[model samples]
Target: MKKILVITLAALLSVFFIDRSYSKHNQAVIQKTLINEIKEHRQEPIVTIDFRKLYDFKWDEVYVFTPGTSLKNIEQTLGFTWLDAKSTGIKNRDDMDLIVFVENNQVAQYIMLPRKYGTLQPMAQKGNFMVKTS
Candidate 1:
């Protein structure tokens, strides 16, 4: 009976340690991939964004965008289109509707709304910092 109990406990402990290690490793890989994707599409010679600071308050993910960063750039980096750029009213300085909300110098959320509608619609968001979208 004692030997059986000892073996079961050891197995449980091993599984727990293995899971923790795998989670950490997976997160590191995801972070590295995101950074590389951003760097590959950015117009600047050196990418300046520090990805470590943008932690998801709930989902454990990161979201980033800058003022001049175009919707096309985001589409290329993320490999998905959230909204049509033409419909977002991002024409010239007067019609521009892109906004990058930041907290503590890190991009918390990005929104693109049409000028005519004048309503907030998140193009990309992360965690509890911004409204969740489907």
Candidate 2:
């Protein structure tokens, strides 16, 4: 009886570990997909003559890419509600306002813009829109 009990416990442990590993693998796949989509769309090159031109990129089609996270999950994790986001109103700009259901500082997200019009003041400007965590 002791031998049987030990074997059962070992089997259960093995199953637990297997399940955990499977879950991690699934999560990784999803993350990779999200990153790829972002890079392909959000990070695309700019080639336009107007302010709204940047929205022509493939990434613009994807309004939101919640990576394994729901609206409620974001609110709980970041401790806030989704506000508003919009364009910067610049020419050939791809900047985006990522209004979230959370505060800033919880996440680090940014975009690099051109050095034209001296907007960055003698330096390359990168906009950072992180979830403000207080």
Winning model by lDDT: 1
Candidate No. with top TM-score: 1
Q: Model 1: what TM-score?
A: 0.36
**Candidates' C-alpha lDDT:** 0.44, 0.34
- Return the clash pairs for model 2, or none: 82-100, 82-101, 103-131, 103-132, 104-131, 104-132, 104-133, 105-131, 105-132
* TM-score (C-alpha) between model 2 and the true structure: 0.35
Tens digit of per-residue lDDT, candidate 2, span 13-86: 99999976775575455435433434444433431112123222122111222323345554454554433212
When superposed on Cα atoms, how far off is each prediction in RMSD? 16.5, 14.8
**Which residue ranges in model 2 land beyond 4 Å of their true spot?**
44-134
State how far residue 108 of model 2 sits from its true place (Å). Answer: 25
Tens-place lDDT per residue, model 1, 47-129, is: 33333344333233334433345668755654555554344444433432454334553433444422332222323333322
Candidate 1's error at 7, in angstroms? 0.5
